[model samples]
Target: MSTLLLGVNGQVGHELRRALAVHGALLAPPRTRLDLTDLAAVDDFLHQHQPDTIVNAAAYTAVDKAESETALARRLNTELPDLLARYSADHEAVLVHYSSDYVYPGDGDQPWHEDSPTGPLSIYGQSKLDGDEAIARRGCSHLIFRTSWVYSARGSNFLKTMLRLGGERDSLAIVADQVGAPTPARLIADASVHALRRYREAAELGGLYHLAPRGVTSWHGFACEIFRQARHAGMALAIAPERVSAIASDDYPTPATRPLNSRLELSRLENAFALELPDWQSQLSLTLHDLLP
Candidate 1:
């Protein structure tokens, strides 16, 4: 049976395709090949492919803009995934979906568990949480891996942003209040592949899992590490560490409020799958190595 992968264009999707290349016959549909917004097209594509498994990595990720375009975001984040989940349930296909750490309430500093009460502060977060519920309600064999602060060498992410700013600016004032694991897309994809390989044999699985790097760090800490690596690599930086002052979340107000604690409890995943994600610093170093010219 072939494996059908959706959202082949996103960072995670791209990395997943590369990692899963040798696993089986992979059928990936980019936006041009398969428009997920079109229900008819989605239904048709699933019917034709009839894949043994489906991995959905595509999402409407514009956090600030989602506040204005709530309807569009809901359609993509909520309805579309539900449609795919229903199809997967009917076909008895193993469905693997990616979720975010934003689903947790921004109130505390505790590492969020899979069963924690969800209280999304922004429209995008709310929509994503809704999508998770939608997928779970299908009652199909599924795994919803919730990850946070995803970055990749090839995609637009916090690490890439820091690289550009490091070269251009004298310093950057990053938020120090918000804390979470800075997960690499490659690691997330690798973990998904690991979990899916044991889907059938693992009895304690088939539920949500928190998959991120072992340690957590704020955005300010992440930027500091980025520059440190860049300098070690002999890359010139205009900014100095002292100039990179830490600021509160209110200093840079946005259309949507971000979670103060995006840290996720990965005990369930580690205990069940015996998988341990790398630390944020190590992952950042590897990603920067790939990004450096």
Candidate 2:
């Protein structure tokens, strides 16, 4: 079987390149060759390659910047996925796509389920929701994994940002109001492979699932843990864990609004695939080891 993986350079895509390679022959094209934004080019390539499975890991992730660049964000987050979904349906191929936790309303403290009602607060979230809806409407064999607080050793994510600021500054303030599991990209990739295997065995296994590591933490708490792990890993940091202060979301205003509640329940995913996800701290520590010396 041949699999086409998009966004190969991204945090999750980078790890997926390794995880998906074991399953079958994989085709991961860089943006220069397979630009998702160019519909005609992407359609032409898909028609020519005709992959059995297409894993779309690419997304418009600039949450704050997306508020201003609405057109670009919509094209990437909504239109592109719609096109891919149609292509998957036409080719009778399995479509595996990544989504965000921002689809849920940011009000409640309860963990969001796959069937939870969605009320996106920002344009980025709305676009993602639209994409998810469009994919479902297309009636293709697809697996949509809604994950949150994703970080990796290689990417410019929250973990790396904290590590950089920790080394340069004596003190830092993180938004404690925002809560979610700090999911590792490696874990997501592994879970995707597991889900793919199950889907191949039973086509009914393809659907929306909340895939996140167990346990939860506020942004401030996550930042504190990062410093602790980095310090234990013999990495130098100017700011101590105790020096990091927790602040409200209002304290740090941005162009786009973020969901205070990003926690996602993973029982549906675990039960379906018979997989036990590790705790967020454990995954974070492992990633820190890779990021540090």
Top lDDT prediction, candidate number: 2
After aligning candidate 2 to the native by TM-score, how far in Å is the CA of 143 from where it should be? 0.4
lDDT tens digits, residues 210-237, model 1?
9998998999999999899889988889
Per residue, candidate 2 scores C-alpha lDDT tens digits across 176-241 of 999999999999999998899998999988899999999999999999998888888999899977
Q: How many residue pairs clash per model? A: 1, 0
Q: Global lDDT of each model?
A: 0.89, 0.92
* Pairs of residues at least 3 apart in sequence or in different chains that clash in candidate 2: none
Q: Model 1 segments beyond 4 Å from truth?
A: none
Residue 289 deviation, candidate 1, in Å? 1.0
TM-score of each: 0.98, 0.98
Sum up the clashes in candidate 1: 1
